[model samples]
Target: MTDWAAHEGRCLIHLLPDVITLFHEYVQRNPSDPESGGILLGTVHGPHNQVVHATPPFPTDRRTRCSFDRGSEGHTEVADQFWRESSGIIRYIGEWHTHPEDYPSPSGIDLREWKISAAKRTDGRPVIGLIVGRKAIYIQSTSATGKALVYQALLGNCPALGH
Candidate 1:
């Protein structure tokens, strides 16, 4: 189970509208063609479904160790923008990326990389791993059974640092 509380106080789990906005933005924001990506975030206030506060997509560049590897080094500007755009009412929470595949989940290598990311943080924030593609967002965590559907509203803020 990626702890729903994993990234507490550090990042935001964006809502559907916000998620969709990022999806569209990424596809158009970068000239990298298939290489472009963006971040998704929202302030999750819940009883299961509510948004007392929100944020928008913060654009960032994709950094990969190998050009073919589906991974990146997220830029700081994205996080900074979340603060700036949200009027200081929100902060960084997690990020999302797209894969050419209709379904994008963390690849084996992607999982390895996430572990490294989680290890570097001292704030106990949940580093969200989102794979957006084919009109769907799949959620994966330390305890997820398979792909958790974003459309179904499966997870919000999980506490699993990373698998």
Candidate 2:
């Protein structure tokens, strides 16, 4: 597991082992490989949010050397399936995509997309934006109230962290 705390320390985001693997598997390793990404599925409880699942890139998604546009085809179906299986405990908590750079950061398009996602949430929970680079992963969360928190982790042997 990998852990990150909100800016104020009021919230914590846990990306489980499986989710981390998924992110790592899609790294833009090859110079020609376009970016890839999918929606994050997880469970939220108070200030602790656990990311348990992540959808893989679908053929429907649009990909370029520097950008990824998640299509609707398989993402929603997977989210729905997980929601039903988990009795609504699992859900779409955020989005993640790959960047060709070694250390990735959110682009202007990413921030705008996150803002739109946060606004669509009726439950007021935060929306997560993750960018997986060749050597690191960036995580940012925007609360329903418009507050934001961010973190980044370097990848190696996938060391587990937190209690």
Candidate 3:
């Protein structure tokens, strides 16, 4: 796992190797695509949020030169299965998508979507948002308390931090 401190060290974000691998493969497979993304799943422990799993882009996902719309087709079923298999340990935590820029930053749409997702959280916990860019990957966590912290990506055994 890779750890990142946010909110001036108030929150810790951990990215698992598996999730990183998934993102790598997805990006490699669609090297020329403008955007691609899916769901993020994991568990939360106190001030630490661990992301351990991620879904591949759905077949029905809408992709464009600048945006990615995660399709819902079969998503609920997959999330339910993951929750059940983990014995309620893992749950839907956030969303991740790709950007064509070297250092991608969230757009207005991204911020709005994150706020909506945070507001609907049943556990009142923050929802993570990730953007995989050509050079670096950006991560953010937003909570019900209106705190949104951007995390610094920590690459663990991954070829490069900004790959």
Winning model by lDDT = 2
Candidate 3 on 54-84: residue-level lDDT in tens? 8888888898877899886956677889899
lDDT of candidates 1 onward, in order: 0.42, 0.83, 0.79
lDDT of 2 by residue, 112-158 (tens): 88988998988877799988888777889886566678864434433
TM-score of 3: 0.88
Candidate 1 structure quality by residue, lDDT tens digits, 131-163: 655444555432122222232233553221111
List the candidates ranked by TM-score, beginning with the highest.
2, 3, 1
Winner of 1 and 3 under lDDT:
3
**Structure candidate 3, residue pairs in collision:** none
Q: Evaluate model 2: give its lDDT.
A: 0.83
List runs of model 1 lying over 4 Å from the truth.
1-16, 25-33, 44-74, 84-89, 141-163
TM-score, candidate 1, is: 0.53
What value of lDDT does candidate 3 attain over all alpha carbons?
Answer: 0.79
